[model samples]
Target chain A: MNIKEYIDTANKKALERMASVQPILIDIELEAKNIIPGMDNKTILHAGPPIEWERMCGPTQGAIAGILVYEGLAADLTEGYEIAASGEIKFDCNHDHDTVGPMTGITSPHQPVFVLEDELTGKKAYCTLNEGRGRVLRFGGWNKEVLDRLNWMKSVLAPTLKKAIKHSDGINIKTIIAESLHMGDEGHNRNRSGSYLFLSELTPHMLDTTNNEIAKEVFLFIKKNADIFHLNLSMPHSKLIADAARDIDYCSLVVAMARNGTDIGIQVSSLGREWFTSPASIVEGLYFPGYSEKDACPDLGDSTISEVIGIGGFAMAASPAIVSFVGGSAREATLRTRRMYEISAGTSSIFTIPSLDFKGTPVGIDIRKVVELDETPLINTGIAHKEAGIGQIGAGLTAAPYDMFKDALKAFGAKYL
Target chain B: MKSNMNDLLSEGPKVINIGLRSFYEASETQGIKVVHIDWKPPAQGDIETIKLLDRLL
Candidate 1:
């Protein structure tokens, strides 16, 4: 085919891929089946950028070990050491299940997750509950406190969320996200507005079912960390939409997000179920007080994938405060978001950008754009310590490596006519 | 006249405020008319003046 034919074919393939793709809900219960609940040495944890054990960051590794001890998967440090060597227990990447874990992102059988389903195409995605604690599972740590907390989430928080969501007749997260962006949230790195919106929508239901005292605590929990609570929704929401654009043989769209506690992996639209991975780059940005890059984990988690589907960093212009968190000027945020247009195939009908005079937010990542411009998508993500249990140490900006897509594209070209 | 000058700059028109003396003299000597009207908002920033000299036509 000539260049014109190629261009037309590529664009059409991308659009068709996006339209046919569906986000499926992979219930956490289903995922948990793979894990033998309670810690055992058999379970091993890994992290971002494909680093060796010696090079592994501290906090993430700590979290991984902590979960093992907590789960009783191993007796103690000595036995856990033996278990690690015995390799009797299973160690796996969250991405293998169409899930992305934050920091340590350790999800075991005992944990319950909100499986976000794509009603259109019957595909599903999974993510663990928002560990009310800052440095919980996603960051890789399990201790008595963490275990107790996870128990509460499974027994109390998850059920309450279910009841509340059911009471509200299903939360239209996309709507809340769009509204929040206008109210100063880019929908990822920062979620103050979205958090409030979520609470407001869920309050009536929460109030109707529970007593004022119980309701108050749950309300406070959501309100206090309204910023991060919405993260759970954003991840599944992005997964839902990205899944919507999946499985068109020749269509090019993004399908998966994985951080092996080492490198980040992404699947492409036309690539057809194959992962295109790149070294997880270190995040660059301002951190919370007393925290520095040294305390931060390399880029880990599936949350950044939300930006890949648009509304994370791509809508940064709408939330200027993120400049402080993700390390860039307000103008740079605007430019960064606008730059995404160079790599995307379309804009989301549900999400809009306020800074660009309210243009539709870019969505549906196109491999052709990546190949043609050599520009990969930019994701704003949180930093966790390499050791497990230390929790979140910071937040920053990281770009998807182009090499992954370039390789995927090569594979795609060779496969198709 | 001074008040009118300020009003012209403030409400009447957006012109460079040549001092009252020069403006008054220019109007007086050049047959230009100066009118004092109700104080309105200043003219917008779009007005410009053009000059053409008749050479050997």
Candidate 2:
């Protein structure tokens, strides 16, 4: 087959797989060595593709130190630093272990993870719980307060959520995502609606499973942190969808987009696990009161999974409220979604936007279309501080570099057509 | 406006391009037929008239 014929056949198969996926939240489980295969005391799973400790960005290193402190392997920050540098702990990519996370994306051995399974394909994916917002370990905050928060999440929150999830017989994540889009959420930076939808489904179960006191506290915590509460659930949902559509021969669909503070990398379906990387670009948008562009780190997180599955930046038209943070107007949001359709293989059958006349969100990012149009995928991301321990500075928008797509196209041409 | 996307997409739809020829060129590359509308400011760059028209509209 010629190039176009090959791409047409591959894209048809990719779109079929993408459309067939049904990501359902199956259970909440403790992340023990037995649960996650190959997980052990020394294993530390960080986000994005693999990188050595010496080359790890500030936030990732800070998160590692924080994890050590949380696990009681280190007495203090200084000790934590020593332990990390001494190579006592192993660091690997979360993707390699069937897991995903938000910023910094650290998944220690004992952390609790949500188990998401695809009902159609029976493939599963996992993600750590969201640590709520500021001064959390995900952004590399390693203070006593951060460690205490993790302890509470691991002890109090995880067990409570586990009980609730059991009582609810596994909340349908796909339903929450679809409803959230209609109620004004793109399921990435702006998850207010998604969070509310999740609480609505989870609250009744929590009420039935737990006592009033603990239930009230859990409810209040989720209610207060509505913006990021849905992120943990959304990440694994995206991962399951991507996993279902992945590994098709000659398929140029991008299955993953991720960043460690130093580099942004993407994996294409046809190329299997090979990553095309470029230096992470600085984000441009509004910042917090005491921070500026100089304080912001490059884009970081596995949250880009949401974008790959076509809801985050690709469904911006559904969430106009995101503009206040991501530095664009409502018109621009709609335009961005419209433009994405040009480069995508097809529209999603599940997630639909009300503002777009109930049109399905664009899905299946075709690398051939990207290079042909010279348009890169836009990522809606949270900005972490350049230094560890500073937490989130702001949230904004940035595009994957054009060079990454160009390089992927060249590789695809050489390997396939 | 409730768009009948099916109608628009029935025969590999025609695009009504405005403001940029590059958009038309890009669409053409994807086998999308284009009909360019040569859009220009109504009052030929008259600031006062444009401001008045904005309020009137």
Candidate 3:
């Protein structure tokens, strides 16, 4: 067989491996460092590809400072910022640590993380618990309110969830995501449906595991924060499937695409951990009353991982309601999904869209198709305020840079040909 | 003579707007049927990148 045959077979094998993954929410860990590979007491895991403190964006730096205080390493938020800049802290990519995080993706040891295991392979992925809406740490808001919320999660929320998930045995994340798409969640910027489904699934178990008072508190917390509460679960579930598809010889399928506020990066299946990066793009969408485009950060967060497996932006056709939040017409939403099929290597058998006549969501972003057709992967993401201390101002859509895909394709030629 | 203008009046001129959604949207507001296609020059208009992409399987 020729090179085309070899590549075709390898891509098929990679997609099959990805499809075999069954991500189950196994348990919640009180301390992430105990489980996340290479994570230590002083290490702060961030999103996207790797970068150090000096080059870190405002939100990322702000998050690191707040996490330092939250971890008790610093006397106060000021000292936390000082220590972060002091080079005493080691910042690494969450993706490199077998974990994933939301905007700024600042995760420390003490923060509670949900543990997900790919039942097919026993491979696990972790993500810090989501901190609901505005004035939260993920969007760079760090203060008494933010740290207080973190403390509540670590002391109250995490332990309660730990018990409830244990009592339920395990909840299948793929099932929730598959159902969420049908109910108007693309599993990235909009996860209200997924959050509702997750809470409903775990509520009964919480009653059995914890006292009624504690169960009621946890239930109310999730209920009010349903806006993006399920995003943490979706991130790791995407990572698990992407991890399962990694490192196939001659496979040009993209396994991961993430942003660290400063730069956006992607890793193709055969490229292993090598990152092809470019400056992150500015998101174009509506903003809340006071904020404007100038106030928003360049595309931030590892949440784009949702688009890695063809949900999020790729399945926009499934969620017309998103147009109101992300700034586009309902027709444009269906067009987005229709266009993704041209670039994807295969359609997901598990996640299907109802509006599109139950067609599988486009899966497996093939880099060759992207560069050849000049179409890049787009993700629906939340907008972070460029300045620290301000949380999410809005939600919107953004596309990955084409230069990264071109560079990845060039590297693929040098490596295989 | 049966003119071309007569033909356009009976069968409206179909508009296929390429590369800009704004243009198609403007036409739609006027109650004209139009289709929008998002397009761009392939490979960033870089000939070398385009050629390299083709060479790889």
**Model 2 Cα displacement at B44 (Å)?**
34
DockQ of 2: 0.02
Please state the CAPRI-style docking class of candidate 1.
Answer: incorrect
lDDT of 2 at B49: 40
TM-score of chain B of each: 0.24, 0.51, 0.62
Candidate order, lDDT descending: 3, 2, 1
Per-candidate DockQ values are: 0.01, 0.02, 0.56
Ranking by TM-score: 3, 2, 1
Q: Quote the B-chain TM-score, candidate 1.
A: 0.24
What is the two-chain DockQ of model 3? 0.56
* Local distance difference test scores for all models: 0.64, 0.84, 0.90
Q: Which model, 2 or 3, shows the larger DockQ?
A: 3
- Write candidate 1's Cα lDDT for A177-198 as tens digits: 7799889898887888888987
Report the C-alpha lDDT of model 2 over A1-417, residue by residue, as the tens digit: 665666678878988887677788877777645466678998888888788899989999999988888877888887888899998898888877788999999988888899888887778888888888878899987777888888888898889989999887778788898889988889998888888988888889989999999999988888889988899999999988887767888787999988988888899998888889999989988899999999988889888999898999999999998999788899999989988897798998898988889999999888766765556898888999999998998888998887787678778766753
Backbone clashes in model 3, listed as residue pairs = none
Best by DockQ: 3
Stretch of 10 with least lDDT, candidate 3 chain A: A1-10
